[model samples]
Target: MSIQPGEKLVFGAPSTLSDRLTHYCPGCHHGIGTRLVAEVLEEFGCIKETIGVASVGCSVFTYNYIVADWVEAAHGRACATATGVKRARPDRMVFTYQGDGDLAAIGFNESVQAANRGEHITVIFVNNTIYGMTGGQMAPTSLIGQKTTTSPRGRNPKKEGAPLRMAELLAPLDGVAFSARCAMDSVAHVNAAKRAIRKAFDVQRQNLGFGFVELLSGCPTNLHMDPLSANRRVREEMIPYFPLGVFKDVTANEKAGA
Candidate 1:
């Protein structure tokens, strides 16, 4: 069929990058989280003025899909890099995309310290229980008794310790402007996740202090389950450990209205 110059393409245009399709497994939450962030950036019309700091783990390649200015940082160093970027470009919106293993495990110091300083930035943390990219190892957020490559039988709370509650951990910090936890197992949950992401960005736009949104995502490939089962697990297993809701919303305290 011949196409005219003014004719629109029949196929829907791609919302994300074509050169780099996501490597995440089916039903994995990384893709959903990425979509939410992209949508928020587009909605706020800050794609050009926004800077993203990509961290390690399954989401390390987040820079490839997000259509915005981005910087690659070392494992767990996304917050540090974001701090520098925000400090240099106060007018630009800065955010960090990190995983549980990267943020709560190896990057715990950076993550907590950044929130302590009340850095004007947004942090999107994806917690999938296991280390998706690193051979399904047990991460800091791994639930008690969850089996992983490193923990063959299961994670023992006595020896391995319990899962980390990231939002609650930072909720009491004076520097933290906003902190919330959401899931991506269902449409309702996904919508809620999007709202949380948008709120985080809105806070940053207002030059608010640190804002954090921890998304309880799925690692279907690492969890060794089909899409449906993985999502089910998120509802049945993950929610109890990491309840989904807004931990704090202090946007009104921000100097600029969010």
Candidate 2:
């Protein structure tokens, strides 16, 4: 009973992630996103030097989950907070953990402005299509016809508008050195998410420019589905609406050119 599931396995939990039980619902992919970020920080040896700007929402608890210096930011102001931290603490790595509601809705302007200015920071965005913690409201990234507390009749694109593709939108910015969208429904996608997370941090570590990766995660509780069904929804419906892949990676291109 003492030995945990993978206690004696080849790979254990990333030290950057605390031992505390996460507050996420069963099958929620936020844990995967957080674990990947922690692993990336560990791989880069920046767990201590990294300053996390925790955005409002369920994601804000990142301060307690990740072993890093973190500053809680006002709702939808994570990018703005990360910008200030990166500017003042140039010696440290700065990153923000945001949600679809925070990044694509209320904080859209701040996120765009920071990326445009080429702020040397990373953005770990979790887009589950709905406001996971805030009573499952329809987010800006919610797909057309995706039902939520605010869109119970299924989203009306004619009125609510189509979902926002943040990764695609951010990739075209000259200041953005890396932008990617990844999913977490399966092992392959989870692995790809790790790679994208690592690259996002590497962008700042290399002083390239603003780095951003949007992770299409699952909100099983909000979606009123069991773990398996939620994952299936991601694989079927969500993936079709929000495709995954690296939208941009200037660092990779430069290396290829070299």
Each prediction's Cα lDDT score? 0.88, 0.91
Q: Residue 29 in model 2: shift from native, Å? A: 0.4
Off by over 4 Å in 2: 1-7
lDDT of 2: 0.91
**Best candidate (score: lDDT):** 2
Of the candidates shown, which would achieve the greatest TM-score relative to the real structure? 2
**Model 1 residue pairs with clashes:** none
True-structure lDDT of candidate 1: 0.88
TM-scores of all candidate predictions against the true structure: 0.91, 0.96
lDDT (10s digit) by residue, model 1, range 25-95: 77888988988898888778878898889898889788888878889999999999999999999999899
lDDT of 2 by residue, 1-258 (tens): 246775676668988988899998999999999999999998888788989999998888989999999999999999999998999999999999999999989999999999999999999999999998888999998888888889989999899888999999999999999999999999999999999999998889889999999998889899999999999988898888888999899977988999
